[model samples]
Target: MAAKRDKRGLSQYRNEYLAAIAATFSLLATVAAAGWSSPAIPALKQDDSPVPITANQGSWIVSILSIGSLFGPIITGLAVDRYGPKRTLLLSVIPLAIGWVIIVFASNVHIIYAARFLHGISYGTAYSVTPIYLGEISSNAIRGSTGVLITVMAKFAFLLEYSIGPYVDFRSLAWISLTFPVIFFILFFWMPESPYYLLAHNRDKEALSTLRWLRRSDESSEQIEKEFTQMKALVQKTQHDESSLNNLFARSNRKSLGIILLLSCGMQLTGINAILGYAQTIFSKLEMELNAAELSIILASVQLIAVFIPTFFVDRAGRRPLLLLSTGGSLFALIACSVYFTFDAFDYPTETLSWVPFVSTLGFIVSFALGLATVPFAILSEIFPKSIKANANAVFAMVTSLVVFVVVKLFQVISDSAGTYVSFWIFSGCTACTGVLIHFFIPETRGKSFEEIQEIMTVESSSKEKTKCLPLLC
Candidate 1:
């Protein structure tokens, strides 16, 4: 009887873990497309390249993916709400596979541009959908672990691309990267739809059934029924609330949106994309003895290792502490890079400090993967009510893409004009300021259920109002 009562045990998470891993394959494909430019651009600029591209064209190839990111959210926002996350995610695979096919047969830079634009669309869609899907299916007990997989899978994909892209021809790399989307579609097609999505659509019976499967419990199980009842009530409440852009940004949700935007900006402006996009380029400029490709592999390997740290401790340590440590660590790493570049700019003897750039960069990647890379997405999945969750995610994802575009586009210009030290200084300042803001503003969501998290956001918003009134009262 005691064993029968243990329906919510760890064994219940087996299916949820499986489903989350399947969703990550889509993310793998998306990140591979984003990082492909890192390796493929160098090959394209080679004198004997098949599709010769100027440096200007190469930059467009990388940054235009962010342009595609801009439009992907709109499609995902519409499709995800109507068709549900599973189907919407399946549909996203079309553009990704098509994009890779175009790349495989590309005859010119313009064709590659179109292919990359499609890749960006998939990038935006995957980021918007995967977290929401994982969050909806997972119990609060393992939600952080599942949600952090998004970053872990993305880092793995980046590592895979950097490891493989340098050795293969551009077309061969395209052929290899295309397999991820195909595998995602195959694996994810059979997974159950989110119980929340099913309930929202008035498929309560199916919702109950999916909940049972996800929890590995029976229809007659008391714990499963109780859990299903709570989920149904939350879904019913959110489904009745009108969803619109105005409603999403209204006072009730304004705080969540603000937090998401801050996290998104901090994640991008601290130089993740710029570094990943230009790692080899930066290393080559320093005349590193290890060669650019070897250094890039090392950088990516470090990222793969660092990103795994969150999956183990996110739930145990909580989001706020990891995030605080991440920003603080990143602040120091960026300052180190800025200081080194400052010394180099002054033509000081830096022969002994050749390792600073690589070491600082590795430090930045580790700090980023530990929290900034993972926690934001986990918080994203927790904070929003179901009524506007998809809309909020789409908005957050779109803003993330736009910011990445600006950073990637300007990194080269800034480094060329004012020197790389200035770029690092700018990033360091941004990280410091963002960290302070996050410390004061962003609330922790570890171990919080969707309903509990909504209540916390509402309370926080109300407290903000009361604090504002206290000043006037005094």
Candidate 2:
């Protein structure tokens, strides 16, 4: 059974709505700062007439950012658990701002690489910390939507950079990116820390205060207290173990870890990043006549439109069904592209083959926005126990960055050597495998409470028998 919800009046819901908007804005600021730098990297590489930086060298610079981001989650997870989200977020802005400054002034490929690595750390920390903060502060009824809001905001950031990066100089784009971090630093000072974190650390009075501020009424006091007690109990249950990191892989946690890791990995294998990162090159190979700027605008518009589909239906339609639909849709799109490419390999006319790749790419993007892009973090946030949520999230982020790095790098080599059709086929195979895994292993989490989710995951039962377990803690 789902946990009972706190009854807030319409006025209170309004306040919560305002707070969610504020949190979304904060997230957008950080994401814009991190993502804007990426679109500029390709441009910087091609700025050879002015100054030479090979495309491969530019890619290396971008890859280093992912490497640096791999560390952000681990470091910020500990900090967020200890000092709270507000402070950790405040600290994150410094590196983001500095990294942009470095990128703006960088004279050579090596300097760009160093700048990206530094920015990666900021990106990593922000990704983990912001979601944790949002999850903690948001009402359960709106939690999934709140998580999607972050994804939506990040997509907007990506779109923003893609649309504008081509028009402006790389240095100017880097400067524009700096504005987000500056505003984040300024506004984050007023934002509240996660009340859940306070309770975890035994700061009960402060936790109550935060609840009051966030909830804006005494009506939820009982519910807030109940939640605090539950969090405290969970923390105590898990506190005795000194090995915080390894606890994620402990026997009891294995299923939870498995679900998170597989889902995280599946997210990358959907090939959304591969599509977005290489959209222009893919279009060029298809014999499309559009320039870089025109292609980027089209790509960005498609992504932006696709994001709205999930935003509207994610809550009502449920996670598992949407995931299945997304996987199947993406597979169809990829296979179509593969078939078209195969036809081209046999000397199909350019006029015939040109539109095939274009339509295939659009279908792939739409499918991804519907499925992999929307649900990975949503599922992750619900699956893990609060005690290990941060650490597990860090691990998830690290794995995602690693996969993206490998996929992006591999896509480049394979697309260059083997051709576009082979690349699409590879991604198609991955999506098919992910669909099979989801069908057999992934649980339906929509409309379920965190505690209900824990019980469902921990209990073992016969395939034909439904298991009814108590909430794991509280």
Candidate 3:
């Protein structure tokens, strides 16, 4: 009986793990879609008519998708909270598939923009909802690892697209991206609703049944019951004062929300997306001049390699240190790139100037993948209480998407007017400041329970409040 119980527990967890991995296919799809056109330089230029897309216009087309993504989190949050992740996830895929179809057949810039916007919505919701679902279902022991695993998969998808994009037509890349949601939609229908969601709606029997399925055995009723009891207690204690958009800025919750939002904003300001979006151009400025396919492969491969740095250290080094290190490293790389550009602008020898920017670009990718890329979602998932996790995640996704949109657009404009070197310097400055802010404000959150993390944030906020309230004499 004891041996059987252990085996059952392992089996249940395996099923849950498989579901988690399947859910991440949405992320993979998002990456593949986002990067599909990035490596198709010849096609992009060839497709242009009498009035070609300027650098800025090209960036705008790419950046406009973020505009759509900005609203996805908020909308999906409400949907997920009301209907549960199962329905929300299933529905989210429709927009992604539709967006791909549009991109695959797009003839005009306007059509591409429309398709991108739709894709943005799907991307935003998936980014927000996946974590909420993962966190709700995962045991605390593996939550952080599971969250990072999704990111790793996302990076791999990006790399895969980059590697293959050059060899195929842009339309084919869109078709490949469509495969994920199709698979996810089919497989996900059979997966269980989040146990937390079931309990939230007072569906005890159903929650238990789902737990049994997740655990892969009908045994361990007592343990499962205990877990449910604890969940019930937590829900009862916190449900009355649960967070909503209106109360997100409430006195008790505002500090945590601020931390999460700032951290998210910091992630974007690190220039990861801006660089990735313009990787081909950046390489050109560096004097490397890789063909579109080669550039894509390099960028994707770097992104894939860099993610491992965080994966190995996140659980060991804690969040704040890794964030600080990555940000600082990125700042250094940006400064190096800027210096190289400054030289090039002044007519420095081509051979010397070229390699400087190339080296710096590699450093920037390393820094980004090591820290900023993996941490934002992980931190967001941890900071919010269960009651507000969905809304908070939505809010985070919206803000991140909006910031990415602005940054991508701004980088393009600056690159067009001021040159790539000057543009990167600005990014460097932002990253340097981000490092400082993270060091001072963000808390370390490795190995802590959800309740413990909440307590830490709560106590820190309370202490700050009291310090502000103290009189001059006291």
Best by TM-score: 1
Task: Give a tens-digit lDDT track for model 1, residues 140-250.
Answer: 999999999999889889899999999999999999999999989999999999988898888999999998888888768998988998998888788778788778867
Which tens-of-lDDT digit does each residue in 1-474 have in candidate 3?
A: 999997865565786677777777778877665665466533565544322465556776678778888767877877997899888888887888998898778877678788888888888888889888877776655566567766777888778777776677777877877887898788778888988788889998888788777656565678777777777776666678756677666655666777777777888886778777766666655545556457657767877788867866786788888788888888899898888777777787767556666667778888887778777666777877778888888878888888888888888788778877777777888888788777766778788867778776663344555563222101
The CA lDDT of each predicted structure is 0.88, 0.73, 0.75
Task: List the candidates ranked by TM-score, beginning with the highest.
Answer: 1, 3, 2
Could you tell me the lDDT of residue 202 within candidate 2?
82
Q: What is the TM-score of each candidate against the true structure?
A: 0.95, 0.89, 0.90
lDDT of 3 at 77: 70
Off-target runs (Cα >4 Å) in candidate 3 are 1-13, 47-52, 212-218, 221-223, 289-292, 459-474
Task: Per model, state how many residue pairs clash.
Answer: 0, 1, 1
lDDT of 1: 0.88
The regions of model 1 sitting more than 4 angstroms off are 1-9, 459-474
- Model 1, residue 49: distance off in Å is 1.4
Candidate 2 backbone clash number: 1
lDDT of 2 by residue, 34-114 (tens): 455346656665636244676576556545667888988988777977888778877876777888898788787677777
- As a TM-score, model 3 comes out at 0.90
Better model by lDDT: candidate 2 vs candidate 3:
3
